[model samples]
Target: MNLFEDLRNKIGKSVAETGQASKRMIELSKLNYKRKEKKREADRIAEEIGWIAFLQWEKEQDIRVNKDLKSGLERLQYIQNEIKLLDVDIEKVKSDKLLYSDNFYPTSNSPSSEPSALLIYLCPYCAHQVGEEDRQCGNCQKRYY
Candidate 1:
C-alpha cells in the first residue's frame, strides 16, 4: 500500500532523472561544438584583417587618412567586435553549470580493467562545467585551483 507507493515514486524519480541528464549531455555537446566553430571563424577573420591592413599600409605609406584604408579599418573593427560578441555568448553557455553533470558508478568488488568513474568540474564563479586539466573556466574564464 503506502510502502509500494513510496517505492514506485522513488523508481520513477530515478528513471526520469537519468533520462534528463542524458538529454542534457547531448545538448551541451552541441553547444560546445558551435562555440568552437565561432572561435575558428573569428580567428580566420582576424588573420584576413591583419593581412589587408598590412598591405594597405605598405602600399600607401600611411594609414591615417586614406578613404579606402578608413573603410578597411572599419571592416576590421567590425569583425573584431563580432569576435568579442561571440566570446560573450560562449561565456554565457559555460555559466550554465547543468551542462557539466558528472557520471558516477557504484563500487564493485569484481575485477575490471576499465575505471569505474570520472571527475567532472564546475566553474567556481559561474558554476559552469570545466575540465580537470583546463586552465580556466570556459564560462567565466576564471581559474580556480
Candidate 2:
C-alpha cells in the first residue's frame, strides 16, 4: 500500500510539472507573437511615411513649374509632421509590446508578488492615465492646462 501511494504521488507531481511547463511555453509563444506583430506594424508605418515623403518631393518639383512654391512647401511641412506623428505612434506600439513581453516572461526566477499599477502616466492637460508619455496627448494636444 505504501509503495502504491508513493508511486501515485510521484506521477501526480510529474503531471503537474508538465502542465506548468506547457503553460509557460504558451505564454512565451504569445510574447514572441506580439513582438513580431509590433515589428510588422512599425515596418508598415515606415513604408507609408516613406511613400508620403516621396509624394511630397514630387509635389515640390511640380510647384517649381507651376510657381506655387508656398502651397507646396506647406504641404511638404504637413506631410513631414504626419510622418513624425506616425513614427512616434509606431515607437509607442513597439514599446508597449516589449513591456508586455517582459511582464509575461520575466527573467527573474521568482515571480513578482506585488500587484502592478494599472494606471499609466496621467496626462498633464486632461489628467487621464493613457499609459503613454508624450509631448502631446492623444485626446487633446493642449500644451498646458
lDDT scores of the candidates, listed in order: 0.60, 0.53
- In terms of lDDT, the poorest run of 10 residues in model 1 is 99-108
Error of 1 at 55 (Å): 1.4
Candidate 1's C-alpha runs over 4 A off are: 64-145
After superposition, candidate 2 runs with Cα above 4 Å error: 61-145
Alpha carbon lDDT of residue 136, candidate 1? 89
- Residue-level lDDT of model 1, residues 110-138, one tens digit each, is 53343223344666787665677887877
lDDT (C-alpha) at residue 82 in model 1: 65
Count of clashes in candidate 2: 0
Using TM-score as the measure, the top candidate is 1
Clashing pairs in 1: none
Full-model lDDT, candidate 1: 0.60
